[model samples]
Target: MAFQSKQSMTEPRDRTGAVQGIEGVLLANRDRIVRFLEVRGAGDGAEDLFQDLWMRLTDRRSGPIADPLPYIMRAANNLMLDRYRSARQRELRDKAWGEASATHAPSSETSLISREQLALVETAIAATGERPARIFRCFRVDGLSQRDIASKMGVSLSTVEADLRKVYAALAVIRRQFDAS
Candidate 1:
């Protein structure tokens, strides 16, 4: 809890005689912080989140924090929560965007995909196999959540996720072929 001298105040928390910027403390604990983030559900984004944390700390006036490491870590956790909320909202918006305008007819303006593109997409989806195609339809066309689709299809959640991945891989191949021509 002791304050370091102004000269080295920007250094890592462990150095007793001096204090440094929050950035220094964060840099010193980079591995630990990123590991914490990974364990906290950041997955592959932990490193990116660490960089973002640095940027967030950049403009703030350097002040003597009694526990700089934990303070910054708490900030990272908040960032993750904010990210999760933003992604959830975006998914909700996308789902709502796919809903019927009226009479179950797709809105042309909303879904501007050409008939040719739709045919390509449908063919690619069907090529994945019956289960994957069904899963794709249940999730995308039926607008059911993966969990709901799994329950309805009598499959495990992981099975649903696996089928969706297969379907997406086929769709990716279609996209590449389409882009080439």
Candidate 2:
């Protein structure tokens, strides 16, 4: 007789497999998620929120999520709200007094670079041709995947991807120019 462990069934399909799957999902959606937050002034913590969302998704405490996409958006939004509250406090301090009185410290150079990268992304998004720009905004800014964007726009996923490629190419050009300058 073969013995099967009870824990095996609920163990994330396989530890490495789950991690890989989650990583892939994050990579596929990360740029768009960060860009979405960036345009909304949450750019400073976009990557952090992205990481946090992935963490929440992978957390055993939450158990299995029925729908990961909606869950991710909700998590992202909540994290963004928390970040906004903290930022607002800093802003108030800076406004009432000055940088000297500000208790909240600024983040590191890497974080600043991330924000700059997001800015370049936005510039590129804006520069894209009309339909592409709209599609990119729907996907990147709204935190909707290509499938969701396509469905909402009444287009195909391939069309959404084509739009993204154009936007990405424009962003590359913008990033290069920004780097040089």
Candidate 3:
């Protein structure tokens, strides 16, 4: 047919063996592949992944595939999965970096971990005896001055000071343990 000759003249053919069929199938299924990626949570990166698929498809030498469509589709799915894994890993790395570099604010707020810390401090302070524990609660919780705390507890100012020093020594040991862990 003269029309076949004219068509062949107008269109370029693949000089390479298997790439010709793959490129043809790729071009035909590009839209489907992109949609597939979006549905797999690729979002706006679907187009980028499609381009990646194209580059990767042509990356290695291969013989002709008996089932090019499934092969190409599987490759696209695998590419999306690879992207997901890489993004997940990046997020975890960034979170770990942020936590490691963040300033430690022990008194800022209470979370579950802070509750455990509160328990530890309570245990250490309780070990100092009832007088020191009451003194600590009055000074830190009631925001009372040391002289007022000594007056309220009917003790000398130096006794109050000594009780506070005991509390401080116990707390400093807990601080060292927290930092080491």
The true-versus-predicted C-alpha distance at residue 82 of model 1, in Å, is: 0.6
Estimate candidate 2's alpha-carbon lDDT, on a 0 to 1 scale.
0.67
Model 3 pairs in collision: none
Error of 1 at 147 (Å): 41
> What TM-score, computed on C-alpha atoms, does each candidate reach?
0.43, 0.39, 0.45
- The C-alpha stretches of model 3 lying farther than 4 A from their native spots are 1-15, 101-181
lDDT of 1 by residue, 67-131 (tens): 67777878888888877767655554565567743443433343334578989899889888999
Per-candidate Cα RMSD to the true structure, in Å, reads: 15.0, 13.4, 26.9
* Clash numbers, per candidate: 7, 0, 0
Model 3, range 1-181, lDDT digits (tens) per residue? 2212232344334326567777889899889988988898789988988888899987746555557778888888888777665665565456557788554422322232356878998999999999998998898888899999999999999999999999989999997786465
lDDT, candidate 1, at 29: 88
Top model number, lDDT: 3
Cα-based lDDT for every prediction: 0.75, 0.67, 0.76
Q: Which ten residues in a row have the lowest lDDT in candidate 3?
A: 104-113
